[model samples]
Target: MWFSKFFILLSVWVMLSIEVESSTHWIVTESGLIQPRLNSPFDMERPYDLLAFLNQEKRWDAIFENYNDLMKHQKVIDALWFDVGEHTNSGTQILQDKDCEKAGNINAIDWHASILDDGSEKVPQEKYLFPSAYHGPSTDVPDCKRISSLTFSMFAFEHLESMMQRDNLSANPEYVLPELLTPIMTLDQFGHWVTGVLRENSSSWLHYHMASMFWRIRGNAPKALECSRRAVHYAPRAYKDIALGSLGVVLHRAGKSNDAIIVLSAAIDHDPTSFVNYFAIANAYSVIGEYNTSLKYYDDSLKLNPGMELLMRHKYGVMCQAKLSLRIKAIRETLNKLRDELNVYTQKQEAWTKLQTEFLKTIKNGEETIEKKAFERMSADNCA
Candidate 1:
């Protein structure tokens, strides 16, 4: 017990030591450049403690005050590690701006709220960087100056405009506008930390998935398809499969079923083991009225998981629905023949009732999918 307690204490101590020595970049030459000095006193998430400290009725006001405070101290701290510049940190700057613009409510990132961005960012013209202290070796990037900041908020706010493009939103009602985005701000480029974090974040693409889904729900398929396609291209391939599937669905809905097929096929190529890929492709094929192709995909789905009773049942459901109207007529005829042989009027009545009930049920449940498949079979049979 003593040993376990001691071990836990040791771990905590190690974490504190690491946090205290937060700066990752160091000047390197043939000789170890300069002896490192003070332990880092500037902890961003901890010192501000936005989640803990800022619990105001007006959340945006709290965020502005807290951020203003954090940046305010950067210029004076002697032991500070990084510097503030406009472009370098600009990637994260618009996060706040977007929230304020979207809600007209400023409290986007306070405590519980999450914010997102779409294509349109509250992009600042220049001088993008977050507040940080620096003396020497601060990199000057000219792109920062291209966009200008008005007041404390970055980006061109001359006209009242949305911070994010219309596409970047989630359709889920649980989400609010603030959950995904904010104003653009730049951070100081020091020891490569600022650029490293921002680049990895792909801040420009922030809230992209959320917004794309929103646009998709509104039948704005073109924008959804384009945004998700970009996300799939730039994001890690494993994480990008959903984007591909979503893009495929948007295409399918917009009457671009062939394009939908191509996109889903790419998903299959990406992960043959994924049942989601098979199902999505199967759905696309079903949409195109290629039942033979749909059947083939159902076969593929079964191969992936024969025990998936759900998929198997869905396949059976499709089969029943495919040649439906003819099957219904045939059932009626077969019932008549059985009743004629038996010459049992009462039995015939019951059989007829059962048949009609089943036919109605089939036509009722999955009526759309079944009807669509029936139309395909009807068209093909007519051509034959």
Candidate 2:
């Protein structure tokens, strides 16, 4: 009975081992490096330390603040595009449904909330509330930047606007003036604002910078490329490196490998120590089968930012392709060397065995000859 039970347990363990070995897929890390994931069905299910997530929230908050400041300055650049009216009491909803429950209060911010509340849950209850319904269009620019802040809060909602659009409560919210209650900010509103901002400030490379981001989020590659190019065109000589590098990346994404290489090369010339520019140049060269140049740039990038897994993966990929191109020659050279070594060893072994065998045979014959001569002498003595 004991033996049978042990066998069954061993069989189950073997089955589980096979299942684990087979259930893995490629996943990209937060740092944009590809890695193997074991049965990760959901984004939240991926392996991550809770402590790190908590620690990162502060950094995320700081980023949110910076985005808000940038938007404010952006509005200042094109104040005409924004509605300028009196301050009005706007009904704004900070949380809805499950988000409100997660915050412990239907209308207050809870710092220790376990639920993953996006920017909505963090909204100030005194300034905002869940609007009963979408308010009608308002030309009034009433007081309180909180409403405007909410529109920009979309940036803090999530890392990618795509993910926010999918998960947020406002899937299809109506647009109203900043003074009135807005359940959510639509991408259409975002695009319109960015377009107007760019149009109003033609010389402001900063507008181009923002337009590039908006276009990228919308998956409009051509518009993104144009915005990046305009950004580069209007950038000051001192800031050309960043704008040029951004343009190179956009070009590479748009499948203009040769153009990307040219732009990235210029960026490298402007800022040779920038590892990101070098890596981008390497990627562009790789697309055109310039493995040697790609490898060199990859190495240069690694020198500038050693121990980055993303750079290492890029370098490793190029190294593999370069090695594959020479695989036939390498294999042939190795086989030839091995064959020569084996042949020399075999010949030496055969010659030593043959010499040893001959020596043994000659010794046996000498012994037989001595025995015969002794036998004959003994016979003569007997006859005498």
Candidate 3:
């Protein structure tokens, strides 16, 4: 009987689990952005060339799914690190073990010192890391620009060169160098490269999108807002919803809470299931003191991604505000009662003071009369 009951419970649990899973609507198109499962067609034994592979169908988004696989590809590694001679840091031990080419010619300059000093201060170069060397007209050192150009071209190859030729990069295009070099590149170089991309393809929302992110990181809210708006305006249909969501956030940062709410709400119309849109709209509502509406959206977003710690915190905060509102009301009521009692006590204290003064005057008069009688008795005794 126990075994039978356990089996019945297990069946019920399985059904409930399936129901929960089914409630989440996972779009295959959106899922393609994530890593493909093993044994999939994209996970073949034979690897693909970086340039050649990206030119394939829906592969631009799908390729990132195989980042580990791409890292192991010999051609991709050789293409990236063909120039790294022998300057390996402690971090490069794994690469050294793998016999990857070290960046010997790449100078180990001490970035911490602000000026190149002893070689000890110099950072040891990694194999895969490509520093952004692009410098724009503002800091246009001809020789440095030339070197930066050569270094980037050599590192990224014809992939970037081809992208530079394109007008619109948002339409199933490949943008690899920025992702690969952003971490290793100086902020100036990244900005310069993004600027160059924008100049070459002004219509490319991708470059503008990147510029918005770069400026935002640098704490330039106005520039970030401008770029974010431009990106949203020029974004392709595939990226429109995401761009709208980003624009909404930038609007919020620009102190346009109402616009942010409207934009984010519209973004939700485009992709209702997107937790980020719900989250952004909720934040906009929260900024305008619409706590209840914000809490509702927050709950909706939480339903989509229940485990998000940030969302949980936001929900908790809204609940705290709601609780605080009640607490504030109770405190106000208590304060009002105390104030009324204080007023009554103040009036009674004033009346009591008046009565006490009259009583003191009467006692003083009686004391004077007793003193007079004592004086008369003293005079009679003296006469006797």
Candidate 4:
């Protein structure tokens, strides 16, 4: 019985192992980079952390105060605000449903209240105020932007506008404006308002890197290249590989494959364990028809991220191309050999015909019957 149970458990374990090995998921970003999808929040990095910090209610209040202050000095147009409301049960209904027994009373019931009460009649009770229906804050804005002490509010406003344009969320009817709200802002006006603010902030290398990604997503190769170069220039030594990898990708996208290879090689030297760097360099090599080098890098990347289907697919594609090139070369060689043999055979046939003509001419002056028979025998021997 114990042996049978052990065999069954082993079989189950093998099945689970197979399932896990086959369940790799990949995502292609808007910028055309392929990456493995992270399954948990723990896998999130610094960029996501910055985004979360900027999303707090307190941060929004600070940004609003800053924007209001900016409006005093400059002829700045007001930012549009949406009054989004929550769809939920009314407060009264919530109270009724949550506390059915004491729904109408403000205080909980006391069993000895009647005994404890004095003989005097209580003064007329004031009308109880029912809780108002719940609504989302009217000052709410989409999460975007960074806060700095000097120009925090201005940057925040521009970031918000840019995000709205990037996401195409402006004029989305789901966020209805309150009737009394009167801040009129148009999409064209947003473009005019945030022109200077939309320039890439050079304060942090991470910011430039993020800007590069944004430009890539927008299909702006030149801007992406510029931002990536700045990112590489400003990145710290420890994090330089990250910036270099991004720069390489931008260069590759810009059709500078040789330059991309050089940058990606530096990235790989900085961090050999990074599979993404290997994968990127492999693609660059593939672009230049360096199949052997491309295959080597692809193999290296696959070694780091085993069982990745996308990596395998890329490696197989390169292998197919290499094989087709070899076959084409072999076919060319065979055709050349056939042509050479045909030339040699043609020359030999011409020489043989000339010799036969000379022999017939010699036989014409000799005994006609005897020479004819001799010539016929010679012809038969030559044919054989």
List TM-score per model, in order: 0.32, 0.37, 0.43, 0.41
lDDT per residue (tens digit) for residues 1-384 in model 4: 875555445434433454353223234479764333453111223322434322322332333344334433232211111101111213334344432322233233211010101101221212111123323233322111321212322211223322223232111111222211112433222222222223433345554554455445445555544555555666677666776776666566556667678878988987787788788888888778898999999899999989775566667666655554555555565555546655654565565455434333322232342244345545755698
Per-residue accuracy of model 3 over 1-384 as CA lDDT, tens digit each: 875555445434433554252222112345333222232222223323333322222332232233323333434334334322221222354323221222121123111111101111112344112334433443321112222222222211113322233222221112233433355455557766666656656665555666666654554554554565566666666566666676566556555667667777777877677787787787677667677998899899989888786676666565555544554555566555556655655565555455434322332243343245335545755688
lDDT of 2 by residue, 1-384 (tens): 875555445434433454342223235469764433332211122224333323322332343344344444454434422221111111122222232233233223211111111122323453222334443343222111111222223212122233223222111111223222133534444445545545545555555654555544444554554565566666676556666676566556555667667777887887687777888888778778788998899799889889876666666666555544454445555555556655654565565455334323322243343245335545755698
Best by TM-score: 3
TM-score of 1: 0.32
214-317, model 1: which lDDT tens digit per residue? Answer: 45543454455444544455445654555566555555555556666777687677667656557656756765666567667767978977767555554554
Runs of candidate 2 with Cα error greater than 4 angstroms are 1-192, 328-384
For model 4, where is the 10-residue window of minimal lDDT? 111-120
* Candidate 4 stretches greater than 4 Å from native: 1-200, 339-384
Local lDDT at 183 for model 1: 26
Candidate 2: RMSD to truth: 36.9
Say what the RMSD of model 3 is. 41.5
Clashing pairs in 3: 84-102, 84-103, 85-102, 85-103, 85-104, 86-104, 132-185
User: RMSD in angstroms, all models?
Assistant: 44.1, 36.9, 41.5, 42.4
Q: Candidate 1, 365: how far from true, in Å? A: 69
lDDT of candidate 2?
0.48
